[model samples]
Target: MRVAILGVGLIGGSVGLAARQRLGAFVTGHDPDPEAMRVGLDVGALDAAGTLAEAVADADVAVVGAPVGRIPEVVEAVLRHAGPDTIVTDVGSAKGAIVAAVDDRRFVGGHPLAGAETAGVRHAREDLFAGAPWYLTPRSGSSGVVFERLTRFLAGLGARPQAIEAATHDRLMASISHVPHVIANVLVAQAAVVLADDGTLPATGPSFRDATRVAGANTTMWTDIYLANRDALVDRLDDVVHRLQTVRADLVAGDAAAIAGWNDAARADREALLAVGLAGGTAPSCELRVAVPNRPGVVADVALALGHAGINIHDMTLSPSDDERTGEVALWVDADGASRAAELVAGLGLRVEGAP
Candidate 1:
């Protein structure tokens, strides 16, 4: 397979490396940065580096790793130069705006929740996305062929790929990611003001250190992310402020019991959220093969059905019959969820082969 990587920075370089080393794909890379292009080729992340048009002209898949603010434009350019069958995806953190801007069947908006504090092509590693949840935000008009290709490619990179709505992805990211960055910055500012006049400031514990770890991260990227998801981030911030006010009220009222209960609730909530990611890690995975006819949205239909039913598809692939009139979609999911997942796929009016 020929893979084109636009913007050979950390994520793009990693994609090139994984595609070359893991998938044995001929990877061509494009980057405006001369140093990135040189290092990407030197580190074997890319077989070749050239102009944007030359990189994507004949690519089977083009992965755009441009900055969040430049993703839509980059994607547009890729589509203009790429083959009609070329599948395009992006690694921008914010998805809603980009998905809206690029209304093409071949474009699938994606965000891989994987990165390091260190940046640049020099720091890119082939295993950076291993085991990370790579979210795909497919449009209503997204081609199932392209979507399946992208998902399989991501899985090949050793990343867990899942489908999600663009709006939902943005909102959830605001709560889980964007807001935390804002809070971290706020914590640092608050701490800086507390010991402004004191020659020796109070020593900080691990809690403070941990909370402010991402206090001032990648200002250029974060600025674009904050503005892109402005409405959702603002909503979450308002909710946080309201909760803080309630805590203040409890302290003023001397409601010791309420304060303790609040702390306990926070602990339980954190555990519950973390458990979602930890669940079924060691569970045996079962494969269910479904016979599907050659169709545009067949793969997407079954994928979305299973996704909506909360069945996490660990892996998937499509095998076409000799005549190409029919195919089989083999899906792997946790053993515990296999029955329900098969039932969901069967409900889509397709025969779930090998289902008990």
Candidate 2:
């Protein structure tokens, strides 16, 4: 399978790397930045493509990993260049607008819930999507075959695929991802004002740091994201403001019981939500133990070997033997990919010690 990546930044590069390294796909990448394209090739993300048109031409799948603002345009271009059977998907955070714009059976809206504060192809890693939630929003008239194919492909990348409607995905993301980023910015702004005089924030705890971690995100990217999902984000922001108003009123009235009740309820709900997330993310996987010499780059060699064979390692741990001469590496892969994983690992002359 040949895969074309529109933008060779972090997410795009990671997708290319995983497709080539873990899915055995011929990956091609195109980016406006020549440096990014060079870095992508150097890191083994993909082969070079002269242009977007060339990248998508004859490709089985084209992933539009451009910024949120440019996604629709890029998707359109991909569609123009892509084969009729080529399945096109986007990694944009805001999906409603893109999904509505692309009226094609082969187009699927996807958002991989995995990233770091850092950006660019230089920072891309093949494991970025491992065990992460990848939301897919299929268009109204999307083909079932395309949807299933995309879902299975995402699973092969070790991402947990969840299907959701575009509108619902936007609203949920507004609450979970977008709004939190806004709140973080707000909190840090307020802190900056308070600390202006002394230029210090003493006695700040982990909670404060955690809350303000995403205070200043990528301005260009976030500006587009905020504007694209303005309506849903505004609705969620209003809800947050209303909740804050309620808390203020309770505090003014000295309603200790009310405050305590609200806190308890919120704590329980948060716990329940986390529990559900844990269970949903833990897919059935197979574990294989392999004996290896305790040496530098041994693990890397094993990983690269599997990568060359298109087998993804979901997780791994190493334990040394009594003499410290050899260690057992416990590797995990999705149950469906286990047989291939074991076969690939065993071909490296290591003793595979588990049924998986």
Candidate 3:
């Protein structure tokens, strides 16, 4: 079980740590950056470090976690060193580019949808992929032994395996990942707080945190993700724009039903979606949507306040105000967290409600 990781950044670094958890798996990392390799070795994440040639030469499984665009080059670089029995896989966010370039014997594209807002080797955590879905895009009826070996490796790391087509993976990620990121990044960019005069951005509370958390993720990684999955993202982006236009029309026309329907669906998602991390618990206490002062460190202050009151917030999201003075925050913790959060914020000599 000697594993060779091509890039030891966030995803690759986490893979190394997770693999090390397995009793017999020996993980080795290969990164072009000398500092990255040094950190991997210093932390004992890799059994050894090597160049492009040495990393995959005798490796049992080659897990490529480089950027989506770099995946092709990384896979190709390692392929030259791959042995006949080696199982080659990748954890790139997008699949089409890598899948198309892979003409090797035992190539499989896998995306483990587990990561954080943070990146780099220091952010690597062993439980990063625990219970996360690892999408496997193996061509139909590939070597059974290769897949078995791959799945055995995944199971050892505590991930659930899902078999899907490469095209399907591309499309799903385009909508689920790229589209949301595009919207969030654009919204954050266009917001007025970004152009504030005092060099002070609007106070960003929880909703802002939820909405813009991924905004700070690797820009190059996201750029590669968008380009690799552009077609599907383009299609879905058009649909989303149309949907927003429809909603805008309804709002302008003062259509009650349309507004209610939108609110209802959003409420449903906010209350439900337990399959996800936040929204899946019991019925919510209050559909609490508030406009909080947009400023730095708003989310933590609010969370601390709620914690003091023993109020449990369920799910929350923030949309920073276009204007520097105000921001909107929506939280759906538990009843207690909500009450305490509000009370604590008020106690801090800050207004609990910015507008409503």
**What is the number of backbone collisions in each predicted candidate, taken in the order shown?**
0, 0, 18
Which lDDT tens digits does candidate 2 get at residues 49-156? Answer: 669999998998888989898999999988988899999999999999998888877788999999998999999999999988787776545554575567668877
**Residue-wise lDDT of candidate 1 within 1-356, one digit each (tens)?**
99999999999999998999899999999998988999999998899989999999789999999999899999999999998999999999889899999988899999998999988888899999888888888876577678878898998998878887888888889999999999999999888887785655778999999999999999998999999888888988999999999999999999999999999999999999888777733578889999998877778777767656556677888888999999988988878888888888888888986554
Q: What C-alpha lDDT does candidate 3 achieve relative to the native structure?
A: 0.72
| Local lDDT at 300 for model 2 | 50
- Model 1 scores a TM of 0.93
How well does each candidate superpose onto the true structure, as a TM-score? 0.93, 0.79, 0.73
User: What lDDT does candidate 1 reach at residue 278?
Assistant: 79
Error of model 3, residue 327, in angstroms: 61
Top TM-score hit: 1
Ranking by lDDT: 1, 2, 3
With candidate 3 superimposed using the best TM-score fit, by how many Å does residue 17's alpha carbon deviate from the native?
A: 1.7
Candidate 3 TM-score, C-alpha based: 0.73
Ranking by TM-score: 1, 2, 3
